[model samples]
Target: MKSKPSGTLSARHIVFFVIAAAAPLGFAVGSIPLAIGRGGIGTAAMFLVAGGFLALFAVGYVAMTRFVPNAGALFSYISAGLGRPLGIGVAFVAALAYALVSAGAVGPFSVFAEQMTQSLFGVTVPWPVWAIGGVVVMGILGQLNVELNMRVLGFFMIAEVTVLGVLGLAVTFQGGATGLSLAALSPSTIAQGQIGVVLLFVFAAFAGFEATALFREEAKHPVRTLRRATFGSIAVIALLQSFVAWSIVQAFGATVVDVANATPTEMFAIAARNYVGDWFANLITILVVCSWFASISAFHNATTRYLHALARDRVLPAVFARRSQRTNAPWVASLTHAIFTLVLIILCIVAGLDPYLDLFVLGSVPVAVSIPAMECLTAIAIISFFLKDRRGLSAWVTYVAPAISALALAVVVYLVLANMEFYTAQTGAINWILPGINLVVLGLGVSRALWMKYRSPRLYEGIGRYGLE
Candidate 1:
């Protein structure tokens, strides 16, 4: 067996990786318009609210590093606090969420890539071809050193941020169409929209930060790096997203809500073209593709790591835990993830689903369900862990903070459930059906854990035994 790679990732590497998973440009081009339409001027405030909740969650999350250190992320934390049975259940939930979202990106990536290819070089290729091409590229990258993937993501991350930053600054300096007002941040403006739906979008935007702890085993200084990366990623994403949203509001002035409602999908690109130039808008379009690629790579890394962690703990086939002798990458797990996503893409094509609408929307539903569920679980795990075993930690760090975070996440979950129709924009059975599928997945996970406990008690005992590596 090849030795596992260790101490190869810095805080910066982890930070960029998490941000890439969040896919700032993709959100800006895709989801932000929807957020603006629904939340109106209060979009920025919702982001801050989401950020605060995550920050509080991070307080206990990072503190867990002092005791539980494993790449299983919420799995390990839950097992430590809750128990191995529940931990195993969450492992499946996390895998399903990450895998669905990762695979979901291929659709958008292919759609945009095909469009850009035809527009730029006049070469007309089918969307599936571009998607398969991305699968090939991502698979190859997945088998390389973790640092190599980090560098690739870093470059793409910088490009995505730079383009948006330029557009944001341009709008800021020009004083927008509204001439710089704080109305967007006003209480009345925030109250005007459906805060529940807006909060769901806000929470979804911050989904990737939890991946920070997933890199614990590879981080140079696991404790410090995890803490810094988690907090930093949340802070940066919140501020950047809020600032960009505000810039758009300023650009559209009094008509911002109307424009967002009318052109939720094209608002950002239109804003870029209007404020910057056609050239910048073109650049933004290009970066949107790169943004998807970066996100795919980031999500690939995360999903593979989760598989590796499970396999390492004997929950999955040990072959998945195998590392490449040369690069020390989780080659088996990466390949498995790649093949899985490729299959999903093929299925979508066969079904004749719209990549942007059907694929992305349905794909995101699992993620929306899984992430908040995990957050709420993790927060409860934190409180439960500290309550049972203080381990010399402060009450605020372990109890108060996590309790507040849990309450916030509970609200998020309620909001998501209450507004599923608005959230998915799908009527009829699909909305309930998609979320129901998640529950079935969770049920299977829990059932598997209970079976393991009864039939293979010893194996179940090792569910979340961190520090094994």
Candidate 2:
């Protein structure tokens, strides 16, 4: 028996997972204002430009879905095209990237959870209580069947998007601070003020899009479903980000940049109040908290599956491959990942780290760095895979598109590395140390793969091939 497919998932379900990971309302209220500050009035176009650039990467990515085994996307794709060693190496890096995202998210999730509670019921509970309690709930949820998890993610995703969409529409209908303007989308604004920085912030919003590929066995019509989910997530994220960004410009009208620069954090809260109502603003604030939790859940599910993929392939421990016969969820791996997440948050708390600056900012650095680096490698892998066997696919999908995407991603990798301190808002050993962790992890993975190649050749052959022995 192949023991394949607990096949109730679809492209729409995967789309829910991906968007939940991106956390549209959270990004809109939190990051977009800062993006506006750096990128200036042209922030709207920057979101679309980043999306278009990723679409180039997606062209080759989706094309190869038919060839690469769906055993955790990044590792399997790189391994199939490049080699088992690099694939194992990527598998480790992929795990590191996704696992750390929760590290960054949990701190803020706690803070907002506390805020939402106190706002609603005049109860000032401490953040640490919420922090540990939050992970506890997700840990239990992680062990359940994924459909249950996806439904929770879906409800939050819809609620946040609806709130943001209503705000945008309200701005359109009532006219904004200076009477809705086209200044945000003006073609002339494209080349203006630090466009590179705009691309940096916007691209980061699109980081978790690959969670879709990990669901292949569970997907109805795996290939087509993967393709649609892959492309569809990109389009929805880009449009939602761009539309709301442009609306913010309209909402504030004339002094948008001045206000964004002056008060980036509170700008969205203010917009929600003026355009809609104070109650709507409160709802948006509550949704921001939900948004961060949704992202944590989405990434938790992604990393658990990533761990299970590696375990079944013998890249890690066989113990992790244990699953629920009834729900088919990877129960053991899910618990393992949940435990890992809890320890990281607890460690940060014990060290007396500031959850916002030290925990959230520094914790997020690896995800911001490693994900782009992996994308570059995967794009290059696609080019290599196609060069050998075109398999009747067009040159564009096979090679041309990925080549351009790889080159573009190479620059993105450099830009992210160069600006680490600026965004992390830290100076000193912390900069190199953060990225250094990712490099060391990647190197260790490569070293392990080399050792496995000679010592355990059969298992090595199965790495990232869905345990093909």
Candidate 3:
């Protein structure tokens, strides 16, 4: 039998899925500081700004969800609104974007796992060994029911948030290194350093925004669950991230830029040392590893789901569509993702690539660009979908909100392109080449879809349909 959703998941469950996918501790230790180094204290506000914009995007997105419910959210949404051929093209991009993202998470998970283990227990393990180990664990989990996955993610998430709470509150109560200051949130202080690159970091935090839609088929009251989960995830992360950034600011006070620029990746470590203690700093490092594992698991789920959706429609081998009836796991698709992860890690290792620099950033950052671009395309498709009939949705829901989202996301795509070096950490041919992978795959998908349209009408009609009820 074809794999089917268990239809037991809920909004709260999906929220964990989304938040864990974004990996809060990992971002605070990683991306947030990068933004601070560029934008000064005002960078914190970008969290709320990005959240509000996504919430607005969700208005039309959720409406479209009710209008066209399916598991392959981006794929089905585009197909329902636009035509199937274009939908297939975007589906291919979305699939590649997410698979690349999943593999990207593995590289760093391995790196930090190696670091964390060696530091905590004084046992040395090679990063490539740790990388394969992560794939094995995540692959097994990916083949189980999502509830089990949520539980595992939930434990790590709680630990992450609890530790983060300590950092923020400790920084506040301790009156900071230079006294408590609200300047980071002040409207007067704007992001000044390479604003495009800074905002790219901010927008990328919401990368898992599509998680809500993708799990809808399994969600009870899918539309209601989607609306609540989408808004809830964005709001939670925005507020949590802002609070964390505020703490980091308080920890360093005016020296935020100097510290961030000097250390880059050590922002969290430095802050923990200042306000909390070395004990807390060490704990943060350990949790950072767990956080990355959560991220890998979350993205692994997304990648496998994409494979299952495509495989079920014959865009891929049908064997990949098989699922565990008892587990509700896309077992075959999960295996496919595990194999891809293994191959990617091996290829990077063979090339003697730095896991974080050459592997993750190159593989993952383009996803930040391409997914937002795909989202822009989906926003436009929503307008097109509702063009003939509003379905009684307000002009705001059908047109206005979507128009704003499309324009904003289009601007985002441009920003990523303009500041490619800042985002990818490379110059010259490789920078463009990394981003070019998205376009090349996009063209290939479009071409194959056109071929199906002419040569196999039956298959063309089924693209992205996914047996949605």
Best lDDT among the predictions, by candidate number: 1
Prediction 2 global C-alpha lDDT: 0.84
Q: Across residues 1-469, which tens digit of lDDT does each residue of candidate 3 receive?
A: 2233448888888989888888888878888888888767777877887787788788888887766656778877888888776777788888888788878988778888898889888999999999988889988899889889988888888888899899999989999988987888875665444567667888877888776888877887777888899999999899999899888888888788898889988889877887778999999999999998998899888888887887887877789889899997999988888898889999999999999987788788669778888888889999999999998879999999999988988987898888888777667997788778888888877788788789988987877755455
Residue by residue across 1-469, what tens digits does model 1's lDDT show? 1123359788899999988988899888887788888777899777877888899999999998767778889989998888877887888889888888888888888898888778677999999898889989999999999899999999998998888789889998999996998777776766888898788787877877998988888888888888899999999899889888888888899998899889886888788888989888778878899999889889999999999998987788889999999999999999999999888888888999888777787778878877988889999999998897688888999999999999888988888888888877778988778877777777777888888789888888887775754
Candidate 2 lDDT, 24-108, residue by residue in tens: 8887877899888887878898778778878899998987777774658988888888887787777888898888887578888
- For model 1, what is the alpha-carbon lDDT of residue 417? 82
Error of 2 at 393 (Å): 0.4
Error of 3 at 444 (Å): 1.8
TM-score for candidate 1, residues paired by index:
0.96
| Every model's TM-score | 0.96, 0.96, 0.96
- CA RMSD of all predictions: 2.6, 2.1, 2.6
- Report the lDDT of model 3 for residue 159: 87
Could you tell me the TM-score of candidate 2? 0.96
